[model samples]
Target chain A: MKIKPECATCIIRQIVDISIEVTDDEIEQFRLVKGCMPVINEEYHNNAVPAWMGTVIHRHFKKISNCEDPYKRLKETANDTAQNYIEDVENKIKNSDNELDRLKKCVLATIAGNSIDFGPFSISEDIVPMIEHTLNSELKIDCSKELLEDLKSAKKVLYICDNAGEIVFDILLIKMIKKYVNDINDIVVAVKGKPILNDATMEDAENLKINEFAKVITTGSDIIGIILEECSEEFLKEFEQADLIIAKGMGNFESLTEYNLNHKKLYYILKAKCDPVAEFIGVDLKDSVLLSNKQLQKNLANIDKN
Target chain B: MKIKPECATCIIRQIVDISIEVTDDEIEQFRLVKGCMPVINEEYHNNAVPAWMGTVIHRHFKKISNCEDPYKRLKETANDTAQNYIEDVENKIKNSDNELDRLKKCVLATIAGNSIDFGPFSISEDIVPMIEHTLNSELKIDCSKELLEDLKSAKKVLYICDNAGEIVFDILLIKMIKKYVNDINDIVVAVKGKPILNDATMEDAENLKINEFAKVITTGSDIIGIILEECSEEFLKEFEQADLIIAKGMGNFESLTEYNLNHKKLYYILKAKCDPVAEFIGVDLKDSVLLSNKQLQKNLANIDKN
Candidate 1:
């Protein structure tokens, strides 16, 4: 989707926040933030993608501050916090009444785990208590049933991940799908090539042991989401071959449609973190959605007809 | 005060808000907002005064939108809202036992009346119940007693007005002051030369019959706050001559300090609407402050020493 004027303020806020996170010296903070103003001047407009603009400015922030990952500490904490719940999640899945129930629980956890994101919190937001919270709160757009049906006949599944801590749950989710849906033979997981706002890097995927379940590849750039031009030939090949694509986080939800992979069933699983995104998605702000790209098209068509 | 990095986002939000307020046509709204991005590009910096930058952007918005007053309806509604409460405020002041109490009530009413501002709300927020609410809410940094003392010795008072609706209560504030302070001979009310935001204009003052209470003058340009460079020599003379300058609203509170009028006993009376301004004033957000410019100098000096 094209950027709203609201995105201009929101991106600047993110830039200023990371500037503060990277430095304590008020003069340095001012310099760091002031220097990045030109990025917004260049990138904010009607035609720019919000995530694409967010990527450019955050990359600029990384350059000016001489910081590889401003969200390093937060990402580590998010990872540690999520990793702590692995055994409990495993136990919960095993205790479920049936494989269908287990699959639903796993899917729900992956979506809910997104809330333990750096975009919202400065530190680790414990996801242990959140398991119960997710169970009680229904997805605003529930497509888990349809997702399972799509998975039943699929030979390959591509899982694109979001944040550091959230990726661990996604790995566990992949395991459940592999076990339950026997037809899903091949699975490819995608993480960012480098750090961009606490997004999972190759190092995070390695640390989390994601390759034990599925072949993990990098998106080849530190962009905010899946901006196709910024991706590698290797990632593009997998994106083309995949039968079903499961995209996580608002960042991926924002950028995935740009690639036109709707012919291949693409399910967007996220907690809409912003107004414009949520409003576009036909949900309330912070609503958890497991929506297909086909559903996105249908929703847009309905809105147009209205 | 120099602009904070956060101010960039805030100014953009203001620009976008007025764009929406000015027109319903989506393409025109986008055009109006996009056309003004260069203003922020030119004006945003560490050393630039926020109100000055604010002035530049809003003026740019006015020019691009081709609408002289985007807030005309809102301003009229605000004035009407405050005008409805004049009799009740008058009766409350008269029924008070002593002149000192009546003076305090009038001062509180002027400060409280500013909440009927455009910056916070889209529509008119009634100020009737606000009178009692104002009486109950204590000032965060009150110099009202000192203000009354200063008014007693001064033969001249320049009440730099803020918004359209709030000026109605301020006119009544002047009437009460003229009655109680026998030494007060000349009372001059300063308003914007043109409509800026929802700030009071010459026409508003004329319509509200402000001339019956005090000589109404304009600051010569439609700037957000007092930009000394933007003011005419005629208004500058009055600014120089006034013994006690009672500046209302956050706009005047922000700009009056820029004029180096600390020696002139300038009293700032308004609710600190945003965090950065409140932080500078050593108060919490939304706290009503009746502070002195000398106090601002003291606060900065102490910070430098610390």
Candidate 2:
């Protein structure tokens, strides 16, 4: 999606959030924000995607603020908070009588986990309420029925995780998927190689004991979302080989939406955070979306035929 | 006061406001905001004053948007809304039994008018409720008694106006001042040389029929506030010669506060809208302040001595 006029303010707001997170020294915060203005002015373009712009702005922010990971403390807090909800989520799935019903509940839990972002606007310390809200609310775009069909036949599943605390919920979803799919060995969970915002890394996977369920690997870049050219060859090979891709969060949705994946089936599960992204996906702000790329392509093809 | 980290976001937000105001075309709005990123990045400094930064950003917004006066329609609306309150304000002064009480009421009315701003944050269409709110609220920094004392002895008063609709209230205050201090000829109302933001200019003065009371002159610059270096020699002469000065709004407060005015008695009457300005002046956000240069200088000198 193209960058909106609102993105400029959103980017600055993110810098402000980071600056405040890094230091209590108001002078230092001011200097950090001032440093970001030039980078935004030089790099911001109407046609540019937010993830691409975010990558550039965040790079400048880290260098100028002298804080390699401004969201480190916040990420830790999010993970700790999210860890508390793991038992409840696991119980929600286990209590379900039917396998398909359990899988659907797991999908909702995974989408709920995507809410724990440490970006500029999101300052919520507790994800329990947010998770509850997501669980209770109906999805704006539910492609879960089709997704379930895809999951039944999928040989390899690539589950791309979003945030730190949210990873625990992803694990719950993975466990459910293992029941229906070939095995845990066939599923590969992709995390960020390095720290960027609150995105989960290999350390988070290790901390959450994700290795017990499915093999965890890194995307080999600190970019907020998956940028194909920046990814490691090993991750790219896994991405190419996967029959079904479950991309989590708005960051991945923004980065991977425009790409021609050569008929690979991808399902985007996220809460539309900003207006631009919401508008791009034809959903309202704060709507939980479960969209299938194959279905979207078919709809577009039908429109072209008309 | 020095620009805070919060100001970076606020400045970009102002750009967004202008971009939306100038054109309905979302693409053009996006382009306009993208253009401002560099100017903000390159020019924003922690040590810089907000008014100085605002001046730069507004100038950039106008240039990029190709709209010379972005707030023209909003200014007209503000003036029209404020004009409706003139009768009520006049009644407020008339109903007061004593001259001093009437003058105090006029001061409140003028401060209330200052609320009619077309800046990034303010989008309220009605000033009646705002006027009522201001009238009922107490000033955070009540230097009104000192201001009245200074007006008693002053020969020439330089009244610097802020926004459009707010000018009507200034006229009311000027009328009250004229009744006590001197004739309208002795009082000169200073406005912006050209259109910038919703700042009152000679055109606004003419639109509101300000000539009925006092002589309105241009400050010889389109900057958000009174930048003395950018002003014409005529305005500087008037600024230097005035016995007492009444500066309205936060814009003037920001730009004029740091200057060494050689012990000139200047009264600032403004609502503390933003956090940094409010914090600098030792008032809570949204609190109305009536502060004098003499009191401010005394406090600073005491701090220096300590």
Which portions of model 2 show Cα errors greater than 4 Å? A23-38, A64-66, A81-112, A120-136, A152-155, A168-172, A295-306, B24-31, B34-38, B80-115, B118-136, B151-154, B298-306
Report the lDDT of model 1 for residue A65: 91
Instruction: Show pairs that collide, candidate 1.
Output: none
Error of 1 at B263 (Å): 2.1
Backbone clashes under 3 angstroms, per model: 0, 4
Off by over 4 Å in 1: A77-108, A116-135, A168-172, A181-185, B80-109, B116-136, B168-172, B181-185
Worst 10-residue stretch by lDDT in candidate 1 chain A? A120-129
lDDT of 1 by residue, A1-306 (tens): 767766765776677677777888767877887788777778877778777888888899899999999999877878887777767777777788976677677777787678777664333245556555764477788777788788787777888999988888887688865754444337888999989998999989999778877888999999887988879998998888888888998888777766666577899888877777888888987778889888889998999999
A-chain TM-score per prediction?
A: 0.92, 0.94
TM-score of each: 0.87, 0.86
Give the local distance difference test score of model 2: 0.82
